[model samples]
Target: MKFDKPAGSNPIDRMRIVGQPRDRVDGPLKTTGQATYAYEHTEIANPAYGAVVGAAIAKGRIRAMDGAAAKAAPGVLAVVTALDVGALEKGDYNTAKLFGGDRVDHYHQAIAVVVAETFEQAQAAAALVKVDYAPEEGRFDLAKALETAKPAKDPNAAPADEVNGVGDFDRAFAAAPVTLDAQYTTPDQSHAMMEPFASIAAWEGDQLTLWTSTQMVDWWRSDLAKTLGVDKDKVRVISPYIGGGFGGKLFLRVDAVLAALAAKAAGRPVKVTLPRPLIANNTTHRPATRQRIRIGCERDGTITAIAHESGSGDQKDGGPEAAVSQTRLLYAGANRLTALRLAVLDLPEGNSMRAPGEAPGMMALEIAMDEMAEKLGMDPIAFRVKNDTQVDPEKPERRFSQRQLVRCLTEGAERFGWSQRNAMPGQVRDGRWLVGMGVAAAFRNHISLKSGARVILGRDGQVTVETDMTDIGTGSYTIIAQTAAEMMGVDLDAVTVRLGDSRFPVSAGSGGQFGAANSTSGVYAACVKLREAVAQRLGFNSAEAAFEGGQVSAGNRTVSLTKAAAAGELVGEDGIEYGDLDETYQLSTFGAHFVEVGVDRYTGVTRVRRMLAMCAAGRILNPKSARSQVIGAMTMGVGGALMEELAVDTRYGFFVNHDLAGYEVPVHADIPHQEVVFLDEADDKSNPMKAKGVGELGLCGVGAAVANAIYNATGVRVRDYPITLEKHLEQLPAVA
Candidate 1:
């Protein structure tokens, strides 16, 4: 179905199941430990284990490798090195070569894999394989490399100018009465997901099947085939359950490639799980960014001019962090400029994580907003409200499909008790603690992709939906079941959703928070076809037929839906395509984050008292699952604010804290309380589901809100991320 224009009153508007807060369909399996992950699959009997050996140096060429001891190790079946694979083609999605001869692009790049009877044996044998490297000096620091940084054009990014500008930003900024300029830094961040990268590969003749933990099923299948130089049709990728992704599992990692190679060398199936210590330097991470923001406003707190420039580093073919994306549209300004500069660095590949561009972008931009508000002597929320725009600031001819930023801020302020917040820093005190509240506007661009699904109507009146869409702990199965149930006129329990299989129809595949809306719309399209098929079999006009209560009604006559498929099961397959609606109208999600923090006056130890998020992201399919996603993102936002950083060892060009022991994340005790509120909205221009993504939106501005709160509490502002206590210790206000 081609979505050429805004959606009209469709079957989903019935709200029988789609809008209800339904429990996850896969909840029982996950909670009961019955959901099998990639490495836990037991279908293949007597599978061998593979342990990867990583290169010690970040950039170099392999002088020689000695695998004799590893070959003779007890229970060792085979030791396969990159030399054995020879020269191989890199996948299009991969920035660095996965496995090849000699060249080392980054630290912990897999050079060899040892296959053995048990995981312990493989790990022991992998340690026995020794290698000699010829190290070379490579660019390791973003600040040092910025002198040679250049504008980068990413194919995957939305079409925009390399240095986008509207009116004369320089003249407007110079003439403005009030202005603020600041520079902020966000450090490199690891995904630090629950499950590590793991895969199980088996071969049947020349065909290969891989059970892997990945977010995009089709992307992995096709990329694996490309990397192996084999027929794409011969490879199958399956991942029914995933512990968590957060954009870490969106690509084809080394585990899947190593498992496939080891299985081929050992003449049996092999399972490979990347060791936790090696994950930080071997896989992708959110790149560190240095952003400079300049805002000019009037005394009345209306923004007149704004400029955002960001610089980030990556490998040779990698793209920039895109930290200026949100600045181009978040506020209304006649003179605006946004630009991104990319530098080459010998660090781990930089890619998407959670909200990606906007996550770090807002971490800097919103803090600048707060600073500008202070310059104008106005409340932060009021300043944001005064600058809210219903159309894109860069392209005013194009209006936003649905914009509720003002509503989000107003509602969030009222609910969070904004009046109780003390505007004067170091004034509000509760015993030994200083209290303050902060607010930041949240924005994430809505993206839609082509997605397909197959729906089956059983003779017994049960409906089944199959797609390659992955859950990734986002409740894809439940929301999909809700969509199918609503469209088929059946109870939610009667519909089954099978996902994360290469053989299934290709879906949007769970990244950039686009999974829910586009994937469910694909299912809706397939269900529409099924409804038409049922109407034809029942001798009713398809246009006039209404499906409800497991019955089809037309012209005052109603018949059981089962009669249409009495002879056999009916099948329908379709996908949702787009024309120019997205181009004509700017689609985006808006939210507001309010955070309260208490800082110990003597020690500078900050504690989050409470948090709340007000979202206006179109119609929410399943409020239960959507709330879970939002709160989870809010937790990650807390981590980003307080203590999540991949400590870089610049001298060696690697992450020093490679293991969980050194890396810090937020624990349950760190988050005192969290509340999520979704506004009642349905965006017709978005899709038939009328739903936009909320997972990423929940995280966009949270870090800034927390940072602003800390500043408000202590009268000290730290522009750097993670807002560590050490950065503000000496500058904190004295306790009276």
Candidate 2:
């Protein structure tokens, strides 16, 4: 089905089963430990465990390796170094050097893989297989690197940076009576998912099968073939379940590649797991950004000029933080300029993590909006509603598919009792703490991906839906099953869901918050075809057939789906293809983030008191899971505002705080309370399901809200992330 217009009433809209708050079908299996992870798959019998050894220096050359002692270690089957693995190449999306490199490009680069009979043996052997390295100095500061930064030349366009502009930004800023100019810094962040990157690769007569934890199955399968110099068809990659990705698993990691090589040498299935510390240092991370935002507004809070220029680093082929992209369309401004510059740094490979550009961009821009609102003597939410834009500011001809940003803010404010907020900083005292409220307009671009799913009707009258779509703890399984059952006119219990196998049809996979809608639309399309096939096989007119209660009826004749399926299992396969609708309409998700924070009077410690988000992402598929995504993202936002920073050891060129103990996310104690409200709405331009992604939407502007609340509590504005106590101690009120 080609989604060419905004969605109307569909089967999913019935809300009979699809939108119901249902538990994950795989939840019980996981909770009971029946669900097997890649590393936990000992069912294969005598599976060997492998461990990786990383280089000590960031930029250096591996001089020599002596595996003599490691080879003598008990149960040490084989020790493979970079030299032992030949003809290995980097994956398409990878930048930092992975195995088979005499010269390391970054710190903690993987130089060797050790395979042994036991996990302990591999770890002990990895430490014993010592190697000599030559160290080299490298630049690690993004702020300093920006000086020599240049516009990234686009190969697809003319040999110039892809730059866009409108009217005179400088003149507009200069003429404005009220203006705010400042710089903001967002530090690098690690995904820090619960599960580490792991893989188990086994070979049988040149046919290789890999069980791994990855986001993109097809990409991993294809890349492994390319890296290993094998035929793509010869390798099968299966990732039936992933603990969590958040963008870290989107690319092929060293675990899969190392496991494949180690299995080839050991002549058995090999399992390789990157140590938690090694995973952080060796893997990709969200690049730190240095952004400068300049806003020129009238005395009445009307925006006249706005510019967001951000600088971030990656290898030569990578692009800068498109952090400025949303800035161009967010609000109405006559003179707007958004520029991105790329710098070179020796940090770990920088890539997407959750909301990516929008997450960090809003962390800074929304706080700027809060400050601007205060400067104009306006309520923050009211000030935002005043500057709302129905069409893209850069391209006024195109209109929004459905813009409820102002509505979201107004309704959210009314429901959250935002009027209770004190306008004066540090004035509202809650016991021994200073209480303040902050608001930020949440915005994230709704993206659509081509997705495919297959539905199969079993002879037992049960419907099973299969797709390569990964769950990733986002309720993909239950929702996809619900979509199939709703279309098939069967009870929800009659539907089964199978997912995350490469042998299944291709799907959008899970990233950018597009998984729930895009992948389920694929399931919807496939079920439509199954309905047609079931009618044809039963000798009933397809147009008049009513599929209800597991029976197909037409012209006073009814047949059980089981009887129809007995004719060799009816199968249906199709994909949801998109059209030119997105171009014609500006489709976006909107929300309002309201946060209450308390500041320590003496120590300057800021803690979240409470938070609420009113969301308007069209047609929530499942309210229960949708709420989970929002609250989870909200908690993640709390970390971004208070604790989550990859402490970069510039002296060594790596993320020094590489483990969970060092790199903190939100714990239960850190999150006070979070509430989410989904407005009754849907966008037809988004998809046939009319659901935009809420996974990232909940995250879009949360950090900014926390930061804004912190400023309101203390009357001190900190531009850097994690707004730590050290940053505000000097500015705090002196104790008597």
Candidate 3:
């Protein structure tokens, strides 16, 4: 089914099951520990354990790696090295090669794997593998490498166009009455997700089956087939449950590939769970960014020219952080330009984290917005509201599908008690702590991908929905069931959702905040088809048929839906294909974040007193799950603002803080209070679901709000990220 036009008077508009604060359908299973994860699958039949051996040097050529001792060790089933893989093809999503090469790309790159009957034996035997490497000098510093950096024609999966602008920014900036130019830096960040990369692989004859924890099932299935030189149909991938991804599990990782190879060699299923330390360096991390933002505005706080330039380093062919993305559309400006430059470095692969581009982008851009507001002696919320654009600032003809940025700002300010905030820095005091409030606008683009689903209506009136969509701890199952129930006019308990299986119809997969909207839309399409089939079977007009009370009615004629399918199960398969609607309208999600913080006058320690986020996504499927996503993102924002740096070791070109102990994340004590509000809205241009993305928008610009609050409280402005007290301690004003 093509979603070429607005969804007009659809069954979903009834809102019988959707748009409710429903509990997660899989919640009980998760709580009871019955939900099986990748490494915990015991049905694979006598599984062996595989332990990875990572490269010791960051950039080097392996001289020799002796795995004979490991293979001959106790309980050892098999041992495989790069030599065993032998000239493998690289997956499209991969930047650095996964295995099968003598050259080491980065520190902790897997060099070999040891498989044994027990995990303990595999771990012990892995240590016996000895390796010699000839190290080479590698570039690890982003700041030092900026001089040689050139504009990237194509940065990873992003567009090749590096610079975009409408009017001349230089002339406007030179003639502006008020101008502010500042630079901000954000360090590399780790995902720090709960579950490490894990997979269990087994082979039967020429076919292979893998149970793995990943975000995109089809991508990994296709990539694994390509990497192993096998037919795509011969490989099956299943990821029914995932602990957490945060964009870390969006692609194929070492665990799945190595497990498959080891299982093939050991003649049994093999499970591989990457160590916490290995996950930090062996996989991907969010790249560090240095952003320069210049805003030219009138004394009345009207922005005229806005220019943003961001520089970041990654491995060759890796993408930049794209920290300039939100600046292009977030505000109203005539002369505007945004550019992203990527430099080649020897760091581990740089890719998506939570919010990716906008997360770090807003960290700098929103702070600049706050500083500009201070210069004009205006309230930050008012300043943002005054510059809100209903249409694209670059292309005035294209209007936003649904934008409530001003509403988000005004409503958030009112709820957060903006009137109580003192504009003067270091004036409001509580005992030995100085308190202040700050605000920042949030923006993330909405996208719709091709998603497919299959619905089966059993004779007993039980509806089964099958799709490859993954939950990733995002409440996909509940929302999907709600969609099916609303469309079929059945109770929520009558719907069964089967997800994360390769055999299921292809879905959008769970990444880029597109899963909920697109996947549910796919289910809506399939259910639409099923409704038509049932109406046809009952001798009723499909268009005029009303599905209610478990019956299909047209005028005076009514028939029980179960009676239509009493002979056998009826199957319906369809997908939502988008047309030119996205091109005609600028679709995006908007939000505003407010934060109040208290800073110790002497120690300069900052603690968040309260935080609130007002979001305007379209037609929230489940209010409970959406709120959970926003609050979780808000907590992650606190971590980005006050902590959560990868702590790079420049000399060794690797992340120094590789484990949770060395890396500091926020605890309950750090976040005193958090609140979230969702503005009621719907965008017909988005899809049949009328929904946009809210998960990433909650995190965007939140870090800058915290930073602004710290500045308002202490009179010390820190442009660097993870605003540790060490950065501003010397500059802090002494309390009276």
Candidate 4:
């Protein structure tokens, strides 16, 4: 089914199941610890354990490796090094090599894996394998590398110049009555997901089956085949359950590679789980970014010109952070410019995490917006409303399919009690605490991808849907069951969803916030085919047939849906493809974040008092799950604003806070009461589901809102992220 045009009145419009707030169907299993993760799978017989030996040097060549001690270690089966595998091809999705050969690209790059009878034995044996390295100086600092940064193209954009622009930005900015220019920096961040990278691999006569923790099963399967130099069909990847991803498990990591190699060497199944410290420096992270934003506006607060320039570092073939993407579309401006510069750095590979570009981009841009609002002596929400655009600012002919940013801000302001916030910073006080409220606009582009699913109608009246989509703790299982139940005219309990198996049809696979909408649409397409099949078997016109209450009705004739498949089980397989609708319509999700903070007058410490997010993503599938996703993102936003940082060790070219003990995230006590409100909306141009993603939208602009709130409370503007109290403590006003 090609979703080339706007969706009409479809079966999903019946609000019986799709829109209802439903509990996760997989919740019982997860809560009971019955659902098995990658390393916990017990189906394989007598599985060996593999422990990886990471390289100590960030950049250099391994002079020599001594595996004799490890080979002689008790319970040690085999010690496989990169040299044993010889020169191997890199995966298409991998920016840095998963396993280092003679050359080490980054710190903690896996150099060898020790297989043994038990995990402890493998770990102990891995430590016995000693290696000598010839270290070389590598680019470790983003600020120092920025001097040599070169203009890079946005991977998501069309083929064009390195810098994208419209009209004369310099001239307009110079002529504007009010202008603000500032630089902001966001430090490197870890996904810090609960589930570590883990995998269990088994081989039989050259065929390999891997039970792994990953977000994109098909992508990993294809990439693993390429990386292992094997036939794609011979490899199978399964991950039915995942603890958490946050974009960390979206690609093939070292765990899967090492597990496969160790299983081959040991002549048995092998399970590999990466150590906690290695997760930080061995895998992907959100790269640090230095962004300079210039906004030119009139006294009335109409944005006349805007330019956003961002610089970030990555591996040699890696792309920039794309921090300027949201700026090009957020507001209405005649003269605009957005540029991204990439610098080569020998840090862990930088890639997507949560909201990625917009999360960090808004951390800087929205704060700039607040600053500009102050310059105009206007309320920040009012200033944003004044500059709202119905059409794309860069491409005037393209109009937003559904834009409710103004509504989100207006409604969120009223709900959050914006009128009570004092315009003058440091004026309002609640005992020993200074109080302030801040708001920031949230924006994330809607993306649709080709997704397929297989639906089976059993004689027992149960509908089963199979797809390679992953849950990743985002309620994929429940939402998919809801879609299938709504489509098949059956109760939610009667539908079963099997996901994250390579044998199933390929789906969107949970990334870039596109999983929920696109994957469900695939299920809808398969159900449509099933409906047609049922109509044909019952001798009714498919177009006029209605499926309801487990019965197919046409005019005065009706028949039980079970009768259509009484002879045998009915099967349907289809996928949702797209045409130029996305190009013609600027599909995006909008939201507004309101945060109230109390700053310690004496200590300059910040505490969030309350938080609320008003989101306008099209047709939320399940309010319960959607709210969970939004609140989770809001919590991450708090972390980004006040706590999270990777603490780069520039001298050594590695992350210093490699473990959770040194790295800090928000605790339950640190978070305040959070409320999420979804504006009722459905984008016909998006897809058959008419739903857009809310997970990333909930995070976009949240960090900026928190930063703005801190500034409003203390009368101090700090452009750096993780706004530590020390950064503004000395500048705080003296205690009264």
Candidate 5:
């Protein structure tokens, strides 16, 4: 199925099943404790447990390991150390070698894995395998390290990069009657998915099978095959249901690889689940970023110059956050530049998190826009509406397939009662608390990827869709079932979905908020072939055939679909292919977030009153699931604004806050009433699904709304992330 041009009104245009807000088909099984997670799978014969021991020092040489004591422990089957992984090879994505030996890249790098009959025995034995280390100094500060850092080594990248303006930005800002320049820093963040990294690996001769909790199953399988020096065809990875990923599980981690190696050594199936404390250290984190924004606008509120520069630290060969990607096309600015700088740091490897660049980038950019709006004595909504750009600023000939940012903003402002908000900050007092309202623009690019799937039409009129797309709690199963139902002209109950299995066709696994739209479009493409097969088998004109109510009809002839499939099951496999349409258009999702917050005068504590998000992403495939994605992201934004921070231990070159207790996310009490409204719209250029993306849009600009609200209420602006009371307590006006 080639997505050459914009999609047309096919069977999906009926809006019978695709547009309905439906509950998850797998919800009951999950709630009843029947869903099997990676670590919970004990169906294999003689499943053993494994526990990992990490190096104590951040940067050090491992002197020795005394595993004799651990081997003497009861039920201790085997112990594998870095020395055991002779000539340890690194994966394509990892820098600062995994399973480090002789040299330590970061604190708490895995040194050994202990396998035993029981989890407790493995843990107890791991604690006994002690080693001596000679600590060495390592870099953890971004600013200090960036001084000597170099640009990433991607030959194909433009500028490689040092983007500059066509016009003088300094002169334009100096001449501008209204301008705002601010610098903001966002701290390193943890994905903090509900389920920790877990994988169960079993070996059958040279072949390996891993039931893991992962996002990119095929990527993990290929990487594992490369790391193990085996054929890619020999490894099979299955991950049908995931608790959550949020970009944390998008890449293969130590649990699966180490479990496979340990099991092969022990000659038994082994399961490894990283302890909550170890997840923050061993796994990747969203690198902390320092962003500087400069916006120059005319007196009437037209942006003349805009720039976004972001900096972050990672191992060599790694790239920066690319936080400026949206700034190149978001609003209208002739003289604009965006650059990403990478620095070397000994902290844990920094990588993608939900919305990654845009999430943190918007946290700073949106607030700066809000500040600029306030400085100009203009409404934030009007300021954003005036600067809306329909075409890509970098290429003026291309236009967006569909853009409703202004509609979203205007509608959201009206629905949120923007007129009720008083411009005066502390003057809007509610009871004893000072109240204020703030709004920011949300923008996230609608990315597409090559995706494939297979569908089977059974004799019982049942359709099953198979793909390697992991749900990650994003309702992949429901949306997929809906897609099949809409395509096959059947009810929702007639479709079944199987996902996250390497045996299935490769798909654009859940990441970058593209999973729902792109993956389901792949399913739609596959089902189209199946529909034609069903009609042909029934000897009916496929063009006139309508599948509904468990029957297929064409003109005056009608036949039961079950009978059409009686001659064995009909299988169809296809993929969604892309052209250069995305290159020709500025494809992106947009939304507006409005927030009301109250700041305590005496305590310097900020509490959210109400929140609302109005989005203009193409089409809503499933309203229920779409709302869940947006609301969950909004809740995450709350955490990013007030509490979430991965405190770095600079002295040790590691993230000091290693556990959930040390790193806090938002709970129900932390977030108040929240609502989301999706504008009825569609973008044909995005794909057959006519949807852009909604998962990451809720995150873009949400934190900024909270920060701006805090400023409006307390008249104190905190540039750093977490907006902690410590940064404002001293500056706050003394209470009466």
Candidate 6:
């Protein structure tokens, strides 16, 4: 079904089950240890273990590699090196070549693979595969390379200068009486998901089957086929369960590709898992960014001019961090200019993590808003509400599908006790701690993708839904079951959901927060077709048929859903294809984050006292799962604000803190009370389900809330991210 226009009174609006707070159907299996992850598939007989050997050098060509020692090792099945595999093509989504390459783009690039009967033997043999490289100097520092930064180049376009902007920012800023310009820095960060990159591969004749832990199943399958120079149909990927992704498993990685190659070479199934230290430098990470924001406003808290320019480093032909994209449409700024510049750096590949552009963009933009609010002597919530725009700030012809930013802010403030916060800093004291409150607006663009699904209605009155959507520790299975149950007018127990199989209809996958909205919309479309089929079989007008109480009714006649399918089982397959609705309306999710922090007077340590988030995405399918996502994001925000930074070794071009022990993330002790509120909303312009994404929306701008709170507590501002206590310890007010 093509979502060309706003839906009018759809079956989902019935709200029989979609909006209820249902627990995850797979929760019991997971808690009972019945569900298995990618690495736990030990049923395969005599599975060989493959250990990867990573390059020690960052940028250089391999001078020589000796694999004879590894081949002679005990229990070693096979040893494969770049020379043996020859030059292979990189996948479209991969920034750096995984294997079979002479030159290394970054530190820890896979150099060789060793397959053996045991994991210990494979790991021991991998160490024997020695490689010599010709080292070369490469750019590693973004701050030092800023002098040579240039406008980002488009891969699809010819050589041309580009700029992302709308109005004359310089003229408006020059005329404004109240103007503020500041620079903020956010360090590179790792996804640090609970699960490691792992895969098990086996080949039967010409067909290859892989059980991998990945967020994008179809993308990985297609990319693996391309990387191995095989037909896409010859590869089948299955990922029934994933511990966590956080955008780290969104593409093909070395573990999956190397496992496939080693299995084929060893003539047996091979399982490969990257070590914890290797995973950090081997996989993609969020690139560090330096952003400068200039805001011009009036005494009434109205913004006139806003300009955001960001600079980041990446390998040649790689994309920038895109930290300036959110400023283009966030607020009502008549004169706005946003630009991005890229510098060449020979570091690990930089890509998506969590909310990507919006997460980091809001880290700086929202803080700028707070600083501006202070300069204007107005409340932050009131400042944001005063500049709210119903339509696109840049293109006024288009209006938001459903904008409730004001409601989120106002309601969040009320719930968070904003009125109790003192306007002056360092006034409120509790024993040995200084207490303060801060708030920031949240924003993330809503994206829709083509998602397909298959629905089967059995004569036994059971419905099965199949799609390639991955769970990724998000309640995809539960919400999908809810959608099918709601559409078929059946209880949740009557619907079965099958996900993460490449043989099924290709789905949007679980990245960019589009999985819940687009994938469920696909299921809704398939159920629509199944409803028509059932009505036709029962001799009822398809358009007039009403599905309720497990029965199909038309006028005065009604029939049980099972009786309608008594002849045989019926199958319906369809996908949700989007038409010009996205262009006609600006689709986005809005939220507000309010945080209270207490800073220790003597130690300069900060701890979260309370947190509240008000989200206004479209129709929330399940409140319980949505709340889980919001709180998890709030915890991550605490980590990003107070900790979480990849210490970069500029000389070697690698992350010095390559393991969890060195990386500090927030624990339960650091977080206190957290509450989530979802405003009632339904946006027809987004999809048939009238739902937007909340996974990423829960993360955007949360760090800035913590940062602003810290400033309010101590009256000291730190522009650098990871706002560690060391950054402001010397500036804190002295107390006995």
User: In the order shown, what is each candidate's alpha-carbon RMSD?
Assistant: 1.1, 1.9, 1.2, 0.9, 1.7, 1.7
The candidate scoring highest on lDDT is 4
The lDDT for every candidate, in the order shown, is 0.92, 0.85, 0.91, 0.93, 0.86, 0.90
TM-score on alpha carbons, each prediction: 0.99, 0.97, 0.99, 0.99, 0.97, 0.98
Give the alpha carbon lDDT tens digit for every residue of 343-397 in model 2: 9877778887998888988998998898888888898988899999999787889
User: Considering lDDT, where higher is better, how would the candidates rank from best to worst?
Assistant: 4, 1, 3, 6, 5, 2
Superposed Cα deviation of residue 245, candidate 6 (Å): 0.6
- Candidate 5 TM-score, true structure as reference: 0.97
Ten-residue region with minimum lDDT total, candidate 3: 152-161
Query: Higher lDDT: candidate 3 or 5?
Result: 3
CA lDDT, candidate 1, residue 281: 95
Better of 2 and 4 by lDDT: 4
* Local distance difference test, candidate 2: 0.85
Candidate 3: residue 409 lDDT (0-100): 93
Q: After superposition, which runs of candidate 1 have C-alpha atoms over 4 Å from their true positions?
A: 154-160, 733-736
Q: Report lDDT (Cα) of residue 58, candidate 4.
A: 89
Shift of residue 22 alpha carbon in model 5, Å:
0.5
Q: In candidate 3, how many Å is residue 471 off?
A: 0.7
Candidate 3 residues 316-401, lDDT tens each?
A: 86878878878888999999988888889998999999888999999999999999999999988889989999998878999999
Q: Which pairs, if any, clash in model 4?
A: none
Model 6 CA deviation exceeding 4 Å by range:
153-161
- Range of the 10 consecutive residues with the lowest summed lDDT in candidate 1: 152-161
* Segments in model 5 whose C-alpha atoms lie over 4 Å from true places: 93-96, 151-160, 164-166, 734-736
List clashing residue pairs in candidate 2: 6-684, 6-685, 7-684, 58-107
